[model samples]
Target: MDRPGLADFLRRRRELLRPTDVGVAEGPRRRTPGLRREEVAMLAGVSTDHYTRLEQSRGSAPSESVVAALARALRCTVDERDHLFHLAGLSPPPRRAARHVSPGLLGVAGRLVDVPVAICSDISEVVWTNTLFSALMGDVGTRPGRASNITWRWFTEPGVRDRAPEEERDRLAAAHVSDLRATYSRRAGDSDVTELVDDLLQRSREFRVLWERHEVAVRRSDHKTFVHPEVGAVELRCEVLLTPEADIKLLAYFPLEGTDAARKLDVLRVIGTQTFATA
Candidate 1:
């Protein structure tokens, strides 16, 4: 790894960002111009000492996951993220998988403090989320590996459907299956697409049946009811906005006009991505 280069890059990027830019509250007594090392560590899911050592140019090479997390925490652009990877002596993530969210998109998501917001990968994996979304629908941090895949969870994990109204469950499952089919078509022969499909087919008889029908459609706009543990039932319309390259999708859940969702979301915003098990 280019230790000095990486250290310089990390420090410079961290220095350029303010607390509010990443949805953090600034302290009245705080005199530091940018985010502290501890705050960056907290945001990047790393230890303060670890981030500190890296910034001091003495740490070992960071794993791919760590680098990616740092890029997101630093709100690096696509090119910047790639440069970071190179400086860390690692290859950048493939655009086909598109796990790295854009800086502009991240900026938008950060400002959406009152609403339930989440960013998903092209393959339906939850890559990032704002606070309210976690409060409403469990935290993205809790969903590791295949658990992070919405379609995989919907099919393989029972009781996940309990969040949605019972009547809409079947249609929702079919809709997600259709969305996966659309992705499968676009990313044909891709290992990321194939493995997820193959695994789901093997694990879920329900998924198998739906995959056979070959449905194709992306869920752009939809109404979903989330039976929140703390907030009760909330009816919201999920609007999907694609990033410029259409590699990632941002899902914003807005309260329906007649629903009590606004108040519920405000409460959830206070709850702030603290997660719990539904079952």
Candidate 2:
């Protein structure tokens, strides 16, 4: 937990992402290049000071639509989008436990073995990931208890920072945790969720503050940019499909307009296969 309050959360998340992450180009002399709060406000259609309050914890809960807009401006992932709601104290409708994946979705993922792909739970747990995902993310997804989690390594481990353009990785991790806090607020007494909350809260500080904001979001979807160690610069269009009959979600990735991301993905395919074979 790196971000404790709105101020820290805003500052931290901004630090982690590069200007390119928010669709801004790397400026000539920007020591740090993520979108400023004012810039983000313009994109999100909110007043600059108002948006600043949301980040600084001066303003209270944001409307659902506003949260969604900000998430889009940030190019958040489904997990991140959901987090936006949680931070705003909104509840998305819940579904049953065992959701089904569409054949079309699986087919699409299967066809993109070159790029990392995964199906995640509403809570950001990685339920299933393709071989390339396992290859790119190392063995985390392959491990029994480590699957379906986004912030585990991103927040707690140091190595992950090298893989993304974010300078505030810890802050973003905290934001996710804060989002989870808002989510679990709805099911506060559930043992499993409670335990997870306790674990993360004990493990990180940023989580504690964002959680206090009591934010929550129900909808999902977004774009993501990652600086893969192997793939120098990569942008991905991330989409989340809600499965019928359950709460499960399928998250998939595809390359952005122009980049060498595809070439790096090929390297990941080879690396993942080689790693798994040796294992």
Candidate 3:
């Protein structure tokens, strides 16, 4: 690894960002020109000491996940992110099919405070979710490994299946399988998608049956119902906004006008914000 170059690059990127750029407030007077080391560490989801060692060029090489997190925290452009990977002696992810969420999409998610919003990859993995989504969906992204995948969870987890109405569950399951099949066709050789398919084929008779149908359909806007534990049943419109690259999508849920779901969503927003603040 180009340790010195990596350190210099990280330092330069960190220094180029202001608190407001990353949705942080300009608090007390700072001795530095940009974000503090601790602030960057917090944003990157790493320990302050760990980030400090990285800046000092004394730590071990970061994993790809760590590098990706740092890239997001630094608000690096696509080229800058690739440079970071290179400096760390790793091949950069493909620009056409990046797994990392874009900063602009994340910014949009941040602005959606009242609605349930999540950023999903092409393969339906929840990369990031807003507080309201967690409140509505029960922290689906916190699941381990492939369990965080929406397709995987829909078929394998009873809790996920239980959220849908009994009559709709079968149709929902079929739609999810068809969506995954479309992704599998698009990214045929991708190991992660392959492993997920293999595992689902083994674990779920329902999935296997649907896969045999060879259905291929892309996800568009749809209506969905959620049986929230606290607020009961709420129906919402699910809208998907594809990024410029079309690799990542922002999935936002909104209540229909003049519906009971709208009132429930307002209650959910208040509860979700409070829960997030305390947590």
Query: What TM-score against the true fold does each predicted structure earn?
Result: 0.92, 0.53, 0.83
Better of 2 and 3 by lDDT: 3
lDDT of 3 by residue, 1-279 (tens): 898999999999989988877766788877787898998887777789989988999888898878877897887878888999999999998775346766776787877878899888877887677778988887765454677689888878787777788888887888888888887897899887798899999999989999999999878787889987677788999999987656678899999665799899888877773433223
If ranked by lDDT, best first, what sequence of candidates would result? 1, 3, 2
Query: Model 2 reaches what TM-score against the true structure?
Result: 0.53
- C-alpha lDDT of residue 95 in model 3: 78
Give all candidates' CA lDDT scores: 0.86, 0.58, 0.82
The window of 10 residues in a row where model 2 has the poorest summed lDDT is: 92-101
lDDT of 1 by residue, 172-191 (tens): 99999998898889778989
- Candidate 2's C-alpha lDDT? 0.58
lDDT of 2 by residue, 1-279 (tens): 112343554566666666644434465777654667777776456789888877666655676556655654565555555555665667532322322233345455556545677766546666456666666665444344433367555555667667665764644554566656655765667655677777767876766666666667543555566765554556666666666532556666677668666677777666654522222
The Cα error of candidate 1 at residue 238, in Å, is: 0.4
Indicate which candidate wins on lDDT.
Answer: 1
Candidate 1, after superposition: displacement of residue 210 in Å? Answer: 0.4
